[model samples]
Target: MVKLIHTLADHGDDVNCCAFSSSLLATCSLDKTIRLYSLSDFSELPHSPLKFHTYAVHWCCFSPSGHLLASCSTDGTTVLWNMQNGQTLAVMEQPSGSPVRVCRFSPDSTCLVSGAADGTVVLWNTQSYKLHRCGSVKDGSLVACAFSPSGDLFVTGSSCGDLTVWDDKMRCLHSEKAHDLGITCCDFSSQPVSDGAQDLQFFRLASCGQDCQIKIWIVSFSHILGFELKYKSTLSGHCAPVLACAFSHDGQMLVSGSVDKSIIVYDANTENILHTLTQHTRYVTTCAFAPNTLLLATGSMDKTVNIWQFDTEALCQARGTEDQLEQFTEDWSEEDVSVWLCEQGLKDLVGIFKMNNIDGKELLNLTKESLADDLKIESLGLRSKVLRKIEELRTKVKSLSSGIPDEFICPITRELMKEPVIASDGYSYEKEAMENWIGKKKRTSPMTNLILPSVVLTPNRTLKMAIDRWLETHQK
Candidate 1:
């Protein structure tokens, strides 16, 4: 388990938002104050407390550049603060609303989107502090809103279980009833490479709600391509309703915190519960990952900020060759060899191998010799053993490879691979032919351009020789 380095107590009430700068942490609490602390020593800095909000500050977030911090409050106002001097840069107010539940800066930091209890989602231009676009949800309050990473789209989730997707112009492009209960939170993942028409897959939304469920949906242009319910898988061990959830930077892992005073980490793709963090004594209110580290900081009603660092090296080490083999077999058994003589027979054979009574080195040597001579054996002592081992490996490989289709295509380009190559074109080719073509087409011009770009030496051959000598020394 990882340990919290230090605890800095500054908030009198629950801390709702905690954001990290390069070396500082800024936290906003219901006490209507924003505190900045040095990350190195967890000591408070001598900055002015932001005192603009008349009510509790409910949400706060930092701009992508980390130079500005934005906070929203129940007083119906959002304030942007300068990180350098702790000065209030701008204050934008909503005409009518109960409170702003969430606010986010666009990836470009050009605009801000705020969601409020009045069911209104407003987009504000950062420069003018003027509302550029506004849209409404019908039945329930807008609980969460997020801008797509590319700035091409945005999505909002409401307490009525409705999820709405809007284009850059603030037009409703897609809307759907996504859950059984009120949608507590929603986020849009940067589009992923897929075998679909769009190069970017938009609205890979992960949502948690009062239904005690966490769900993932793949939304494209407002259409639902597919969705998976992971209530049991993601919130399995927790008995309370989930209150907060966030996807990791890579979008492969999700961390969810609940009112049950527990935080569960899930494999975003498989929806498998990875670990349950049980340090908070009260409801976990929010969680965020550091910009460039595996360190995760979570805040809760327990009046504490728990920082958890993922045990990446330990996870990798735990997944050794034996674990890999077992995983391979488990996947194979589920998808292949169902039409064989009998399931029981295959199970029995696998069970025997599980016992692993045979000498591994002897089996390997015998198998190699048998393969070399077209299954012929001169030594009777090892012949049967070699044949059995070879048969086992062949059976396993066959079962494993059968479920996978031939003509594996690139998920990005939607083209069959000719040869395996990672390209600057943002697509990976799996086939040799495609790779060869791409390489030949792109490699020629770069080499020719580089020759002229190289620096020239003095007119004499001595200078060239001297330059060559220097290069040789540096190369060593």
Candidate 2:
């Protein structure tokens, strides 16, 4: 399951974009500065708030090796920074003195691409910090860009809704009208998917735009065929203009943020919505996934960045994937049980559990009495906690076995809903969770991130009753 781990409110103005390295996070803002934070603790770096840009800092990205960072701005310059000292390595000015909107490092980290408001896209050599090549889009401002994993070709998206593909030599390979109004952002998945043939290099690219839709495309290249861009599918879930999109490093998920103040995560392969997250108070301007972890950073016009994390084991259980279920059930060995206990923050019990040789089957049968007498867990509170955790696992197993309907699960907790209540976002959530969320002064819908029109929560009596009936029938 996905969970919000932190909310950073450090930017002074609208956060334009955010990116993650293997260990650090970089966020640029209209406040005219770029902020660095440690991914380990989300603490601001000592030399953070890098402030050389004379205008709004529009975009930033870390190099593949995590040794350098690139930040572009309306100042008409893209600055390369030494990640170690937080010092500027080079400041390359856009040729036409245009506002730079986006910058990205090539997969190999040897080249960087900066897209400018004047439609100029510049390719800069990382080693020499010199201009490698330059090209421009035909129409409106160039706002978005990304490099293919092979670094053979790069794509640029313009405000005029055009997508142009260029090769390393700066030759325009393909151009097409991609969006109706304008293109907001685009990203290339790092992992290539199988095209059922060994000769073709197939990649997936996700692009979102002002038309409130995200489209996926199949980009294929070969020595003989050169390049081909084929329309794969269109995803329509956002009600307002889509602002940003990114693919997870593994290429299994695609996430997009929108003017609707919502972020939707999609199962890239099936083009299915996996989760809808609403936490940003204003329109989401940018989003990115960490290259080395299941972590996501989202920036918004509200000037805050939200960090989200994926619990892989919990997600597997939530999705009830057959293989994952089998791994978590009776098949789990003593070592597996120890690892799981540690993951559950029950490290103190690891010794006890190992000493008792409690495996997965034994874990499933654990109860308060079993914990207190058999395991000799003396503390009543500790026993209750262990029993509760075991019961949760048991419930998950049983639900998977009984085919629990999705509607019975609470979107927030990913558990069977109790006391479901309809919120302003037209989604139902557990009453206590919704109350806790509102109590924290987060007056936004948990699903859409939109401001609540009213704080009033109507009891979802119908859904509650339906869940009750289902549990009664299934529990027996």
Per-structure clash totals for the candidates: 7, 2
Considering every candidate listed, which one attains the maximal TM-score? 2
Model 2 Cα lDDT, one tens digit per residue, 1-476? 89999999998999999999899999999999999999999999999989899999999999999999999999999999998989999999999999999999998999999999989999999999999999888799999999998898999999999999999989999888889999999999987754313344668889989999898887777655466675655775688999999999988789999999999987775454667899988999999999888999999999999999999887555444433643358888898787667545587899999999998898888878888889999999888878867765665565555476544566677777889887876567888888989999999977658899988888865556556766776677
TM for every model, in the order presented, reads 0.65, 0.68
Q: Give the TM-score of candidate 1.
A: 0.65
Question: On residues 24-71, what C-alpha lDDT tens digit does candidate 1 reach at each position?
Answer: 677778888877776666677788466789898877888988888898
Question: What does the lDDT read for residue 26 in candidate 1?
Answer: 75
lDDT against the true structure, per candidate, is 0.62, 0.85
Measured over all alpha carbons after superposition, the RMSD of each candidate to the real structure, in angstroms, is: 16.5, 17.2
